[model samples]
Target: MVSLICTLQDHRDDVNWCVFSAKLLATCSADKTVRVYYTKDFSELPFSPLSGHGYPVHCCSFSPCGQYLASCSTDATTVVWQMDSGEIEAVLEHPGRSPVRVCAFSPDSVHLVSGASDGTLALWDFTSRSILRTGGVADTTMVACSFSPCGQLFVSGSMYGDLRVWNLELKQLYAEKSAHDLGVTCCQFAPQMQKGTGGNVVQFRMASCGQDSLLKVWNISYTPHAGCKMQLLHTLTGQTAPVLSCSFSADGQMLVSGSVDKTVTVYEASQGTLLYTLSQHERYVTACAFSPMAPLIATGSMDKSVNVWRVEDGCSTHEGKFLPGEEAASSCEGGKMGGHSRLMPSDWSEDDVSSWLRQEGLEALVDVFKANNIDGSELLALNKDALATDMKVESMGLRSKIIRKIEELKMESMCTGVPDEYLCPITRELMKDPVIAAGECWWSTSGFHDCAYEEGT
Candidate 1:
């Protein structure tokens, strides 16, 4: 499902961030410069290597219209670049002059947010290039900020592992402290919006990766009368080391992450499932993004290289086909993806579990399961030892069959669209059934992807 297209070795230092617009791709580096490339052919822009910052650039983003690009740096400033000419449009200084670690443009492109190392956040009016509101948590570095689709709210993540929701005025509306252990590195809101339960509340989905080596998906629901609530949806453990960055595809169906493990991971955003763990980077994969113009991905690394990859239908690796930015952007409309319910199988009730057993022809155990009050969550925790010792199941054949089915269900919650890789949360992992690693231990171990595939499989 993922294949390397090319490796771009332009930056001399660590590639800190990478992003894409409709027709162009932009990358910033610790080398104190930003590079621009045409998506069609990966060619550099005429006025590229946009050198405006006095120090390393930490983040980069393109405006919705692709007319301007923004990059923030350790220089304690956020610079706006006129994309066509790569000219510096304005330099907005952070309120405290603390090194800005992250910046993001609002979905409407009218507002921008820059978070600093001093735990300060400045909201800017992009049109006037002026600061509008200043607020933040004390004593904690602000490392991440993302605006909800409605543009009425944005979320900020601190180095202390706290996730806070702020309104346009920069007032904290909600907070989830210790959202991640150790620290929170990045957070991004899905582009698409969803209506809340009963259709009155406005709901937003966000994905955050942290120093805890876990990537989590959360549902932030806001009701006009009730204010806001944050709920955890999934905790994805696909990376071996700290996850450095995470991004959602334009359609919000696919999610990709780069990690200190030197791997690029792709997932089904809706299900928190792992699709593929791409091990091509020689060093830590620090940045990753999906192109708004095509089913393509660009990953940047501490190895000082940027790798482009193509994601397509099925488990087979192939080159990516192109889609115009407009067409790709249009996919965000309706904000709904068919197939699969939002409530994952792990949330099934005891009755639901019994029904599923009947469907899978484990009817003989349905009464026993009902007596034990097994639910979807408990069902997923079942294992060979538990089945034999705890449940007293004597039939090895029945245990194996039940275990196989459980493995498949476990992967069904990892992501919306899972890839075909073994033990990957995608591709339904029809083959993992105790196959273990290929070329040697196929007779046992390793079977099923954890919840990550929801594409055209």
Candidate 2:
């Protein structure tokens, strides 16, 4: 079901948390540094390690678009860094000067939240980089927090074994007094919305791991009349020791968790059945995150090593990796591309994109793309970030394939060496059906493939 692809041993101390963007991997450590890696081969970035935190870093998260990373530390602040240049974007000080234990960016990347050791939570307007409001639980350390897919609600877990849900206005919507018996270590909302049982109601699923040695799945629903309601769906007991962290696959079909027993467990999220139990970490497993667009996962531990795993669906010969750019482009040329793109990919309409997706054997995704109104230009703009985040593609392999085909289309549109004879005379586009007229010298340019000549002589 899974195989270890590589191991990263860059952090000098205990690895606290691990997170992934479309293109990069970030891991924070008790050594007071955060290391970034390229997921293609698990290679370190040029800047390698980020050392802005004055004290040990406890958690790390990447912004929605993979352009920035946020890391919180015992130094009493959460620092946001530009992903490309490895420079600090802003240093956000937690309220009450307490050690920041956790941080997360909303689905839209418009807001950020940081939880402190004193139970204080600060919500920031990410664009303006200013605190918007403050709220928290009483007498407990804020250790876990995650935003809902709708970007309007978020849930925070405390050391007091409570899970509290809050809106952007800092108003408490729901609170489960003892969601976890001992304490909560981590929680994350599944990235999709489900229709509630009634009209105008919305439902969501969230996964949380705790010191109680249990991995719990929850269903939370909200409506104007009833506010928010939470119910436990399943409690998995596959891990022997305390479960420290948990994450959901982009499509929400699977869940993964790391535990103090030095093992990583993968679960079939829908049925709560254990899929695999990985024990590659030497010390306590502390962190785990699934790549946004690939069937790959990274897990970090107290052993000071990050293990990169390739999840298998039992089909790919590429061995859990994507095809090289050149090979992918050749596949696109060999009729793997969508329908009627015809070298003018940027001129595609919503209907055209649908037709293309259907032709590419992605009929299941046609509605998903149509709901988003993906046009020619929008389809061309589909990167790993948008495919996984905005479109919610489930299979890591599908995300990689779609992106590869899109890149090939982009390359075709940039080609400037087309011969004049192989181009349509009137449209100046590539001629797919070139033909000679009755005179043999007259080229048929009338709307391509058809000859139209009108004259009064």
Candidate 3:
């Protein structure tokens, strides 16, 4: 029942990475541009694209507070932008002209750690807009870096599969270990947890994945004499192909990973129990992340698609429960009861087609139908097979008509800009057909109606 909430097709080439904040999602692509979209309404176009990178952008990260975004490209530079205005705040150029492989923000949101191709890790202090410290140089390039949730430590992974831990406060390397047989692709400090000691003290842990097809969790502890100690806790092995990315859920109780095998797996964080294996993507899964403030996981793939999945009670959603005959009719070829397939039935009734479309959450297509002067109720009443024939016969002319109508509507709306007060506080987007409760704020009618209904407002 892990239904796809939506698929974003804005990127023209392979999507390398995607990151989510409280309200926005930032996706960087081989198209040499970064597109930021509202999480609530994927149908809306990006406010503007970030386009200064001369080469394919490798990675993008948001500040802890979601006020800024940092992206590194093969152009040997990193650009930081104001999230609200999309204005470049700083452009960090590597003196050696080596591409930055990855970048991360400190838990305090004041410092940025970047790993570069020259085997160097640089810590930049945003307040000064300059490099504060640089260390952890290896013969091979650096691949990944992550700041611990406690803000006391940071970790970096090298192309040689070595993992290095550094004390953020002291700005010095604290520990180092050979982590993987092959190059380490991703490393992340798990969300803070209180592992009860015999007394009342608590310890922390971290996780890393590599091209060796292994995921390792490490126990982190502090000692007066040794300063910091990291011990191998668990080794997770299920993926047959190289593991590319991993993420810890908001509660730190679960972990998810994507790999070159075209699958996403969810795991129990502590004992590494496999929970669910989602095999929806058609190509190598490149990136995966858990939302900080919601029970959602977003994954991007080499297939040029982004999928959002709900992570709760075996990935079931309220809207996914099927009625009689609905399951078989909507099931794609080769799709299991809980899986998704691209092949859909062609001889479906209009109601079946509409329900299938709604289940797939194709908001853009729904918008197109609304803009084309087609009656929503009537469209839902027409036979899908007939509609398919009409579409094939008049494809180009129908597309042109829909485009013109959409453009006309956009111009009309532009002439009457939305009132500032009616915008959603979280997304800062205009509320369409807003509905308000007694003392609560107004929300868009289509997207957030579930929240309001759940609250019994």
Candidate 4:
């Protein structure tokens, strides 16, 4: 039921990967530049392209706190940029002069781990801006690296299908195993779950996907005597083509995968059930990620677009029309289709309408009912002829009201906005730092200077 919100076509070439932060989205491209846009307003163009890389930028990741951004390129370098100012904080060069493929920050945001084409991994300490450690020269290109939620361990995947786990504190290899028949393209750890009283106990798991058209989940547990043990939990198979990327939702209850087959698949994490298969991308889907603060998924594709999908109740749902070549099939069946059906007043019962109103809003319900010239009792009575007459007279106004009400409810629930009292009177914008003078009016430091003469006059 996933539908495209909008197709972002800012990249001149293929978009390699995309990462989301609280307020911004950073997209790296094969055009040798990285572009960042406000997640709240995608229509606005990027202020400027991040253009220091000499080659194509392969991947980008935001720190856990969303204060900084890290981007790697085929130019054998990784650049750390301050998110607010877009200033380069550090430029890390690969020790072996190999192209950096993937990079990620530790859960504590103290260290950064990056994998390179020369079969090596480097850990950098951001505070000191120096390489803390470098290892992994097993003669296979390392493509992916991820730190576990506990920040005590990390996992790396190689082009030769090797997956290795290492102790972050000791820098010692903990386990090595073959993960797939082809190169491993992506790896990620599931969010830690609360288990015991007071949420002190945590459960850790990991999932990996690769060019072998397979996805595997593993259970990771620590033992005092044995150290660490990773057990295979499940093998997921659905994609006919190579799976390029996979990500677990913020709650770790859902997993999403994108592949060269031009499809994105959502899976129930507990039972491994296929929740939905999204197929709006005309070309290979290169990357997919779940938003940390919202029920949305963002997918980047080689078709030169980024699509946002809505996830609800462990299923995908959207209100938009189907894209070109997309089939209008049932979601219960096993194919990429739009399974959403528009609901009519006749389709809902009195109880259903009442429940919806309680959950959505009584205001919206009242507005829609008034616009359609139908009482709650009449709506539940299944009077289609009366509805048809009302629709014919004010069809556009009724529809517009319904749409606007829905949008208003959604925005009120999903986004948090700044208070009006915190805004400056002159610019009508948010005041970063406020100073109060006579009358107790708030003004930013710069605005205070401009209004000082006025206040004196």
Task: Pick the lDDT winner.
Answer: 2
- TM-score per prediction, in order, is 0.70, 0.73, 0.66, 0.66
Whole-structure CA lDDT of model 1: 0.79
TM-score of 4: 0.66
lDDT of 2 by residue, 221-260 (tens): 9754467999999999999999999999876788999999
Could you tell me which 10 consecutive residues in candidate 1 have the lowest summed lDDT? 330-339
Global lDDT for candidate 2? 0.81
The candidate, 1 or 3, that scores higher on lDDT is 1
What lDDT tens digits, residue by residue, belong to model 4 across residues 1-457?
5556667887888888888764566788899888887656555334447888999999999876566789999999999887667789789998888999999887656678888998889988866768988898567888878887656578888888877877654355455457878789898898552222221222467889998899888876653224556778888997888999898887688899999999999998777888889999999999888766556788999998888777755321112211111121112111111111112223444454554443222333444555555532344332334434554435554445445434332222111123535444433333444444355454433322222223563
Q: Which model, 2 or 4, shows the larger lDDT?
A: 2
Per-residue alpha-carbon lDDT of candidate 1 for residues 1-457, written as tens digits (9 for 90 to 100): 7889888999999999999987889999999999999888999999989999999999998876577889999999999998878889899999878999999987667688999999999999887778898999899999888888667789999889999998887878899998999999989998756654543456789999999999999999875445789999999999999999998887678889999999989998788888899999999999998876578899999999999998865221111345434433311112221112223555678877876675344777887788778887688778988888888888999899899778646533222332334433223333333323433323222232323233444
Off by over 4 Å in 3: 169-176, 193-202, 314-457
Q: Give per-residue CA lDDT, model 3, range 1-457, as digits (tens).
A: 3557778777788888888775678888888988887766755334557898999888899876567789998898889988778999899876577888898887556578788898877778765668877776758888888887645568888878888877654355454557888788888887663333422223567888999988888886642223456789999987888998888876577788899999998888889998889999999988888776556788988998888887655321212222232332232112121121121222234444344444433333554444343442334233444344543324554445344333322222111224535445544334444555445554433333211323554
Regions of candidate 4 where Cα sits further than 4 Å from its true position: 44-46, 193-202, 314-457
Better of 1 and 4 by lDDT: 1
TM-score of 3: 0.66
Residue 68 error, candidate 4, Å = 0.7
For model 1, state the Cα shift of residue 45 in Å.
0.5
Q: Model 1, residue 121: what's the lDDT?
A: 93
Each candidate: RMSD: 17.8, 14.7, 18.6, 17.2
